[model samples]
Target: MHAAVVHSFDELPRYDTIDVPVARTPDEVVVDVLAAGLHPRVRSGADGTHYTSEGTLPMVPGVDGVGRTPDGGLVYFVASDDAPGTMAARALVDRRRSITLPVDTDPVAVAAAMNPGMSSWVALRRRVGFQPGGSVLVLGATGNAGQLAVQIARHLGASRVIGAGRDAQHLELVDALGADEVVSLDGDDAGDRLGRAAGDVDVVVDYLWGRPTEQAMKAVLMARTDRSRPLAWVQVGSMAGPEIALPSFLLRAANLSVLGSGQGSVTTAGIVAELPALAALVASGVLTVDALAVPLADVEHAWTRPVRPGQRLVLVP
Candidate 1:
């Protein structure tokens, strides 16, 4: 069987041959890999940077993907951390962690949208007690997950959705995706603009969490019409930097709560519970994702390619 093998953390995964995966438990089944996404999480795992990395070598690098079972049923499966990932021609999938998809589902689209979309989906649905008619502000709104957050927030019944990011061109696309307002996270007045536009938002789905987040947090705190109003800041991804210099007064002065949403914060069962609905939404075309399908043989090239904003790369075996 052919698979993407990572012999070292320093080098890119190579297209190589590996033994076929065998299911070891009754709960697990080997499925034919239809499509797998080249998500940032997968990249981090491959490079041994993710918090969940086990420091294992000669590994495959995929978190979740769409596959076909032996009975010809289509499904979306999440790969176990210790097992070979879904980047191979065939991957071992735990049926308990998988969801059955419609026969007409597009594997590439589901593979492309699920992981990134889940970041915002899980954050909004599980991380906070979000209600309909509340306003939301996405900090890094031009990226793939951020763009989806803008739409997802609106679909989940947000009265107002504000998208703030640095890309001028992609920010326009974010607006088209259903953001009620767009603010540029650039220039000297970036914080001022974000504060003015999103100070009153009920929730914030933040993906950038470094200086940008620090500046935005203080700006929002200082500009809120009523500091007593509850504000939930759900930190999803740390795209800019890992740490922020949070001041004690910021937390003490307002009704602000900052919490992270990820593997540890949200349980595996919790994430899987929401997958069926999210997959249905993506499959039904209610939620849109721009995906570029690349052959598995070109994994090396695809891995090295610069990621374009708002576009996802899906590997087809």
Candidate 2:
């Protein structure tokens, strides 16, 4: 079968003939992949520069995808640890890793929305005790995952959702997705701009890292009217760059709790178990997918697009 493969780090991705392995155990499931999600980590790992890089080559570019099996074909998986990505015509997944969805479930919706969708979901539901009326600040809130962060925050019952991004238009789009307020990070005085935009923020869900990460942290620090209540900061992505140098004073003074929300860092078993609940949310329209569809043959080129303003691409095989 044809599968999208990254031949080498820094080289463009390409398709190759891959022999799909047979299920060696009863627990294993074989699938015909229909769609795949392009994540930033997939590109970084493909380029051999990501933190989790093992210098692997000829890797399938997608980590999460929508797929179906031959029997019944009703259930599918969204993420895989050792399972094949959806960029392939045929893939083998651990049946346990797959999440059953409506056969009519929009794979693009699942693909475009799932990873980031799950990140924000996990952030609020697991990391922080996100209250019904609390405020949320999403830094880098327009990237594929970042946009999902804002949406999921709203679905999780955050009273006010604040989005921060590089472009004004992107922030506007995020606002449309239920962000009560949006902040633009690409500015001469981004700190001041963000400080001005923040409104009664109780929880800060941070996906921006490096300078923006520090800058957003400072913005949260400056916007705090109440100093005693803990402001939860959920760090999901580091697309701006991953070196975080947080001042100790923010945590000390505000009693702030900053969390690391790595999608894969958590056990795969936990994610698999949670997928059913998440799938139900998707089926009910609580979760929405904003995606651009790309042909699987063009996987290499699609991975190169810049992330911003609903740049999530779903590979249709």
Candidate 3:
């Protein structure tokens, strides 16, 4: 079998022949990988930067993909944390972790959308318990996940979706993706712009948690006109920076609740439970993703290429 093998953490994965993974337990089944996404998480794992990285050498680098079983059953699966991942021609997948896909579904789109789509879907549905018709503000709304967050928030019944990002061109597309308003984070008044947008929003799905987040929090604290309405600030990713200097007054002054929704915060079962609905949405075209499929043989060059915001590079084996 062939795979994107990571011999060293400092470099890109080499496309070479590797031994096929075998099922180690009765619950595990070997599947032929059809398509795997080159997500930020996968890139971080290959670079030994992600917190979940195992630090093992000579291993496959993908975390999840779309594949087919020996019986020709198509499925979307999440690979084991420490096992050879989904980048290879053959991978051992735990049966329980795999979800059956519809026959007409686009495998590459599902492979690309699942992880990014899940970031907001799970956060809005499971973590914050978001109610329909509420207002939402998506921080860092230019990235792939953030783009999907804007759409998901609107689909889940957000009356008004506000998208905030640093890119000007990409920010223009957010309104088409269901964001009622968009704000730029590049200027010095970025905080004030975000604060003005944060007025009375019910849920804030934050992906960038650095100075942008600090400014947004301050803006929300100052601009919120209603004290009775509850506000849920769900932190999903820290693309900007990890830490923020949050003032004590921001929490004390308003009905704001800050919480994180990933890995430890949301259970594995909880994350998996939301996939079927998201997959169905993708299949039905209710949820759309911009993905480019690259051959597995081109992993080295494709890995280093610059990816535009809202576009995902998928590897087809």
lDDT of each: 0.93, 0.74, 0.88
TM-scores for all candidates: the values are 0.99, 0.91, 0.97
Q: Rank the candidates by lDDT, best first.
A: 1, 3, 2
Evaluated at residue 91, the lDDT of candidate 1 is 95
Q: Please give the distance, in angstroms, between residue 146's alpha carbon in candidate 3 and its true position after superposition.
A: 0.8
Q: What TM-score does candidate 2 reach?
A: 0.91
lDDT for residue 316 in candidate 1, whole number 0-100 = 92
What are the RMSD figures for all models against the true structure?
A: 0.8, 2.2, 1.2
- Which candidate achieves the best lDDT against the true structure? 1
lDDT score, residue 246, model 3? 80
Tens-digit lDDT string for candidate 2 (1-317): 78888787868788777778578789887787788778776677678877766766667767777777787565646535554456787777777778778877777777667776777777777667677877888888877677777877787777778788888877777888888887777768888878777734777777767888787777767676776767777777777777888788877777677778675556767667667777777666775566788888887778776544566888888
Q: What is the lDDT of residue 17 in candidate 1?
A: 91
Better of 2 and 3 by lDDT: 3
User: Number of backbone collisions per candidate, in order?
Assistant: 0, 3, 0
Screening candidate 1 with a backbone cut-off below 3 angstroms (N, C-alpha, C), the clashing residue pairs are none
Which digits, one per residue and each the tens of the lDDT, describe model 3 over residues 185-290? 8988887878788778999999999888988788776887886578999998999898999888777788889899877788778777888999999878887699
